[model samples]
Target: MKILSKNLIKLRDIKTFKFKKAMINYQHVEIVNHFMKKPLILVINCGSSSLKFSLMDPKTGEESLNGIAQCLLSDNANISFKVNGEKQVLALLPPFDHNTAIVELVNFITKNNLFEQITAIGHRVVHGGEKYHQPTLITPQVKNEIAKLAKLAPLHNPANLVGIEATEKVFSHLLQVAIFDTAFHQTMPEKAYIYGLPYNLYQEHGIRRYGFHGTSHYFVTQRASSLLQKPLEQCNFISAHLGNGCSISAIVNGKSVDTSLGFTPLEGVVMGTRSGDIDPSIIFYLVEQLGYSLDQVNTLLNKESGLLGISGISNDCRTIEEQLLAGNKRAKLAIDVFCYRIAKKIASFSASLDNLDGLIFTGGIGENSNTIRSLILNQLSLLGFKANEQLNEEIRFGKQGNINDTTSRPCWVIPTNEEWVIAEQTQHLLINKGM
Candidate 1:
């Protein structure tokens, strides 16, 4: 009996040893797999004459490197970036195009030995039209479709295509994905997207509301959902992306139901340079009565308007704020108009939501400007958004928090991270494609 009991104990010890060994082996394999796998995503946002890039870790939302190549195809072209919070600027050779800028970016990445860990490239395509509501792998056909859609976003799609083609030439071995800024708002219903114009125009010409800043809106609204400890599908909020190009979205139950910007980004609230929501007759008046050419009118509205036009100062809100403090009446008026327009838009958007979870402020102006936020919220008192003045002032310079009084509905200052959204979506597409 004693001999039999000792044998049983020996067998149990062996089994426990084997189980511990198996766990160690499994952990070792996981660690090795993590190190071997390429985990970094290169996110690119291309403007007409600039290229912005970020090396991002999708899992942790960490940006290993961030940079921009500006003034491309000009003598003054330069690439500026930060590594480990240290800023550096390098001059690009003269007459460099987007392709050249990308080549330089690749060289920099290789020099830093980050090229191998970068698994894919994510490009931000400004307008995807009615076709793409999700991130897609960049194929030849997709490129052609993006080119064909350039007429709808003449200012952005061509530039975005340039970035894609440039990256294809530079990073041919890497899988690339395109994330559209207009994709999120694709969930908006027909009533929200359709114009009061003729039905044939909507069917044939596709001349209807396709909202911009969808990427930012999606990022902020999702963050709001997380912060509120509520499921996204149950949350309703109004997200205002007040940047150089501003837009407001009404997100109901995790989807964009209506937005401020329509047909073009110029249809929304007053922006840095855009003459938003201008009367259609104004264009005719400029051409027929004022002897202005159509090209000139287009340039005037898109370039020579907004805060700059109103203040006769800078288009930057920071500068406008400084001037306002110095007793500049036009600066004051510019800010007042900007805040008032946003407030009005917020109130109007409330009608879209059955219940308001919160009001989210994101983008440059929305995140940083406490004064503007206070002004906007003060105007929204009727909607139960009484700002806690102290809380409002505390949430700035990338600090996010709820800034509303206890008696009021939540008013949050959430910083939007569009690049992270692009990175995440890019990673998701790669996984689903089994790449």
Candidate 2:
């Protein structure tokens, strides 16, 4: 049975909170969860410009508080947080980087006495190269290895490590685990992962497909199997995670047999900004034809392409949808190209698995946009799939609902909790050292 209810965590039942608050008011001192040894774990997803955190009970699946510190390195840095079901805004502050952002979180946790209960921390490290196949405890050596992978994922790994270092300094006594985005896709066979490039490049530079969004893809597939009441080993499906960065995964049984993302997130479906699955010659062509330098070309592929490039308006899917509704030509073009690429990849991934049991949509765009879902399903009636429009629209955010008809192949909107997946991995890998 799941530990948390569908509703918000009741604040009144929290004996610790009431007791601590009462003590603070009457006794003028902070109270800690010193009596309990069960750890209050912190799961952190450190991104380039934002830090998302959650305090979760691993065994119970109940969460205390979760929130995001966004717009880092800006004058208008903001902290948007939610405890139970209520949301609050913290004081607006100065510019902060990942390190400073994490330091502030540690301060918040400590001032509120959360640090006393925390026994460990889990981090979502973006790329693990070929070294880490599973979640491993973060040691000095492991930290160095992760640092080395900064070039492979310059946009993510470096910032991820910054959060790790800052948190380690504050919670030096706690056990910490590093969960990697590429870990779940390590099951991909060479037949599915290896590129047709020179064998020497593959051996020398570790240049091969390392699919991302592993945490989200892994958890959703397991949950889908449970929802269908089928053994995951018997389930063959394609899972799509369509946020700013989009990826499609082909799961055979319980494991990821194949996925759309390659060595970088840039090698998949057209995303919010990244040019996905582009021809290699296009990079060279842009340099010669447009008189662009390598940095200029790289910036175009990574930051100037995708929806933002097509629309010339916004990076957000919701904004694009709004523009599309208002009949903006560029917005319509951006969306058309996005869905077309996704539909094309869905077909290619389905071919990887001989038997297709279902197509699951997730992440921001995949979970919310019934329009996108309908458009994709329109081209796939041959596969006996059609999304239930009402259900798709109703349960767009954090609510679980299937979009497929009773006889149709299963399509679900299973809200993702990558933080929970990181928490689970952290717990499984660590033995309780007396807290």
Candidate 3:
């Protein structure tokens, strides 16, 4: 393999307009710039069953278009989008796959002339192992490295690659970038990332912790630092990102000291379906004693457990809360367990830092669900973290504010912008390469 130098080009060497004129296909560049006064970056975040995308002005972080292609490869697969403020959903034909869905997206953008303004594309890859710590321009070499690292993230990286492949087919002329979710957590010390398994396994096979949801954690840390009037490098925080897939991060001096999700997204606080931090012996017990296959066990842990397993109704927190209020014991238990795990992780992560500057709540559940925030903070109130109930109640639906009393430690409800982070990284890489 040919080695690429770390600093191949510098941003100071060229201007963006001149770079665009020199690098991009002349006809497409003319059409792209003619329709927009600002260069737009397209960000893609792909999952097993969904594709989320956004078009944003990288310099201002202003979004122009955003949406998702959900329930892929299913009968109900659909594309939902909003452009310039109007929203619509289109039910795709049956047998819709990632490539077809991406093609549909491209058709819509081209039909509306939105594609002309897009300058570059950014993709979110979940795991990078040790190969990547920074966002990289997507080349053939980088794509091969991503495919090799899929062994460490079988579920996520594969789907991420699907998005990359699909996007490349439709937007061949624009530059593509890969932003690894594991890159930010590469700063974790050995003591935190190393597992208590055979030393040879870790050495030869890379069987160590590579935390997920790092993009969300890093974005919140930067936001929290700004809200607290402190430099990012001087901040210390415990960030709880609660959504379909949840994880908490302990950030020290702006770097991830530790995080909840492990080598995969499955090892974290209980998420919508994933089982987090369960006993390793359970797998053996199921396979050897109860007559289960390894694949079945994997499916159970990754898809059928967590709130869904416990509540026996739905995986959504909102649905669980509704059932709990209607006097369901299992729903209550699921919520209790979820809150307990988050509180426990917060306590443990606090010890990782000399002193906690503040706590940030983000992601879907963390930002919108006041009940979850109150429950988690109440568990930590004895340690000088108290939530202002009225304040918590008022902050929801993309609103951000401090939800803690003046006498207590700072607590913020900051909605995460993972797509924006990807765009920022993509733009920075382009600028550095003098493109």
TM-score of 2: 0.88
Q: For candidate 2, lDDT tens digit of each residue in 146-247?
A: 999998899999989988987765555456899999999999989888999998998999899999999999988988988989999998889999999999
Roughly what TM-score does model 1 have, to 2 decimal places? 0.91
Clash count, candidate 1: 0
Please give the lDDT score for candidate 2.
0.80
- Ordered by lDDT, highest first, the candidates read 1, 3, 2
**lDDT of candidate 1 over 1-435, digit per residue (tens):** 454344323323321122232222323323333564557899999999999999999877899899999998888999988889998999867888897788777777766767656778999999899999999999999999999989999999999999998887656556789999899999999999999899999899889999999889999998999999999999999999998889999999999999999988889799898889888999999999999999999888998889888989989999999999999999999999999998999999977988999999999999999999999999998999999999999999999999999999998999989999999999999778766
lDDT of each: 0.87, 0.80, 0.87
Range of the 10 consecutive residues with the lowest summed lDDT in candidate 3: 1-10
Give the range where candidate 2 is weakest over 10 consecutive residues by summed lDDT. 22-31
Alpha carbon lDDT at 402, candidate 1: 96
TM-score of 3: 0.91
RMSD of 2: 7.1
Candidate 3 lDDT, 18-103, residue by residue in tens: 23223346354445455567778999999899999999898788988899999998999999989878998999898988888787
The TM-scores, one per candidate, come to: 0.91, 0.88, 0.91
Q: In candidate 1, where is summed lDDT lowest over 10 consecutive residues?
A: 14-23
